[model samples]
Target: MYTIPKTSTTDMEVTSIRLEKELKDRLKKLANNKGYQALIRDILWTYVQQKSGDYQPQLSNSDIRASLPATAQQEERCVLTGKVIRPSEGMLLGLTNNGDMVPLSIDSLED
Candidate 1:
């Protein structure tokens, strides 16, 4: 839920990348008042944090608002226990406080 901040945009170097016009338009629509560049930065940060070995999302069972049963369409990692959920495995999709649905091991909620 929280991450270590590397540095502010003030200390960052600028780099350019090209995107399809339609994609850029969609991003603009979604970004709204925050602006597309900031949105892009946020998306990159989320991806990097998820892939980082040291990243442990600051979440708890209490932070999960609900748990909905689901099946893994592809391999997924349980957010609570960091266990691999293979394709077709029965699992639970925990809806977090922030309204994100994350995979959970089948027995994560079991006593």
Candidate 2:
């Protein structure tokens, strides 16, 4: 699932967690225009989706810029077919037009 709907600051609860100074600096650099806290929320949402097996992305074959062969070091779901790519299984990394690299089952290309 995509990130939850955004709400105003008033709708959010205050929570605090400590981060290493170096990591905080790195997050700031990576955050850019989106702001670090928002980025952190997005990351949390993505992690939750993946763990829940609800992380399917809405992509199509035409959306792929290229397909590069690869082997899964860990389980992954093919973006197009939602098929599981078991560890050590040969798969393809579909580079999307938007630059995201996603997993694809080898058989996903057959049809």
Local distance difference test, each candidate: 0.80, 0.84
Clashes of 2: 0
Candidate 1: tens digits of C-alpha lDDT, residues 1-111: 434465677898899999999999999998899789878887777567666744455667887899989999998777777677899999999999988999888998765
Write candidate 2's Cα lDDT for 1-111 as tens digits. 246788898999999999999988888898898798887887888777767887766577888889999999999988887788999999999988988898999988675
- What CA RMSD would candidate 1 show? 3.2
Q: Which candidate's lDDT is highest?
A: 2
What lDDT does candidate 1 reach at residue 94? 97
Where model 1 places Cα greater than 4 Å from the true spot, the runs are 18-39, 52-55
